[model samples]
Target: MPSRTPSSALYKVAFLWNLFWGVPLLLAPSLASSALGLPQPAPGLGELHARAGGLAIVLFGWVYLTIGGNPRAFRPFLPIAIVAKAAFFLLVAFVCFFHRELLAMLATAVGDLAFGALFYRDWRAVR
Candidate 1:
C-alpha cells in the first residue's frame, strides 16, 4: 500500500476518537431501557437516533483523521459542521423548552455552544 500522509494520520486519529466515544452512545438507548426499566422507544425512533449518532461519529472521525492536519481541506467543512451542531443544539433547546426541562436545556445549549467555540478555534488555527 502507498504510504499515508500526515493529514491522513490526523484523520485516522480523529476517526478513532469518534469510533471510541460513539459506541457507548449508540448502545445507550437500549442500556437505558434495560437498566432503568424505562419503556423503550419505538423501533423506528431508536433506529433513527442510532443511525444519526453513528453517522455523526463516523463523520467526526472522517473529518478529524483525514482533514484535521490539512487545514486547507479541513477549512471548508468547519463552518458547515458548526452550523449543523448549532442546529442540533437548537433542537434540544426546543425540546427542553417544550418540556420545561431546565437542566437538559442548560446542558445541551451550553455544551453545544462550547463545542462550537472549540471548533471555531480549531478552524482558525488551521487557517
Candidate 2:
C-alpha cells in the first residue's frame, strides 16, 4: 500500500481539530456564550445560535470524515481555511490581551494557529 501523503495527513488533522473544537460549542452553548461575553440570547436567537452551532458541529464532523476518506476533495478549501484560521487567531489574540474577556482568548488563538498550520501544510502539498 502507498504511504499516506502529506495532504492526506493534513486533512486528518484538520478534521480532528474542527470536530474537537466544535463539540464543546455544541454541547455547552451557555458556556460558549459566557466565553464570548454576549448577552444571553433572546428566546429566538437562543434557538438560532444553538441550532446553528449544533448543525455546524455535525457538518464539521461529516466534512472531516469525508476528507479523511478522500483528501483530494479538500484542495479547494485549504487556502481559504488557512486564511480564515489565521485571521481568527489574530482576532483572538487581540481580544485575549486587550479586551479582558472572561474565558482566555489565548486558547482560541492556539487552536486557530494549529488549524491554520495544518491547512498551510496541505496547501503546500498541492502546490
Candidate 3:
C-alpha cells in the first residue's frame, strides 16, 4: 500500500463532505431541506429531483474516494474534479444571488470552492 499524502487526505475529506449532504438528501429530502434551512419541497417531483441530486453527490464522492485511494493513478481526474467543484460552487452562488433565502447553501458552496482550490494546489505541485 502506498503512503497517503496530504492531497489524498483532502480527497478523503471531500468524500466525507459529500456524504454529509448526500446521504440525508437521498434518504429524506424534506428533512435535508429543513436541515439546510431551505423550504421543504412538496412530494413527488420535488422530492424526486432532490433525491436525484443526492445520488449525483454520492457519485461524486465515489470519484473522490477512488482518487484518494490512489492519487497517482487517478492523476488525470484531478483537473476534472477541480472543474466539477468549481461548477457546483458557481451554480450555487448564482442561485443564491437571486434568492437570498437560499443563502444557507453558501456553506456548501464555500466548501466546494475550498476543495477546488486545494485540488488545484495539489495539481500544480505534481506538474
Candidate 4:
C-alpha cells in the first residue's frame, strides 16, 4: 500500500469529528443539543429535524472516509464536500451572529471551515 498523505489524515480526523457529534444527535437530539450548549430541541418536529441532520452528518463522514481511502478516485467529489462544509459553516455563523445563545456552535462551525480549507488544499495538491 502507498503511504497516506496529509489530506488523507485530515479526512480521517473529520470522520472522527462527525461521529463524535453525529452519534449523540442521532440517538438523543434534545440531550445532544443541551450538551452542545444549544437549547433543547422540542418534541416531534424539532427532534425529527435533529435526527435528520445527524443522519446527514454521519453520511458525510462516510464520504470523507471513502475519500481518505482513495483521494484520487474521489477527487471529483471534493468540490461538493467543500461546498457542504462551507455552507454549514456559513449557516451556523450566520445564526450565531444573530443569536448569541448559539455561540457554542461556532466552534464546530469553525472546525468545518478548517476542514474545508484543508480540503481545498488537498484539491490543489492533487490537481
lDDT of 1 by residue, 21-123 (tens): 4564466656644443334546887766865775676666566555566656668887765675577678767776766634444563565566556566666
Provide the overall lDDT of each model, using Cα atoms, as 2-decimal numbers: 0.59, 0.65, 0.88, 0.88
| Residues 65-110, model 4: lDDT tens digits | 8998888888998888899899999999999889999999999999
Full candidate order by TM-score, most accurate first: 4, 3, 2, 1
Off by over 4 Å in 3: 1-6
Q: How does each model score on TM-score?
A: 0.60, 0.65, 0.91, 0.93
For model 1, what is the C-alpha lDDT against the true structure? Answer: 0.59
Candidates sorted on lDDT, descending: 4, 3, 2, 1
Q: How would you encode candidate 3's per-residue C-alpha lDDT over 41-96 as one tens digit per residue?
A: 77899999999999999999889889878777787999998999999999999999
Question: What TM value does model 2 have?
Answer: 0.65
Q: Candidate 1: TM-score?
A: 0.60
What candidate 1 gets wrong by more than 4 Å, as runs, is: 1-21, 32-39, 101-109
Model 2 CA deviation exceeding 4 Å by range:
1-4, 7-9, 32-43, 50-54, 57-61
User: Per-residue alpha-carbon lDDT of model 2 for 15-111, expressed as tens digits?
Assistant: 6766666765677666666666644555667857875765675575566556556556666766666776788788777766766753465775687
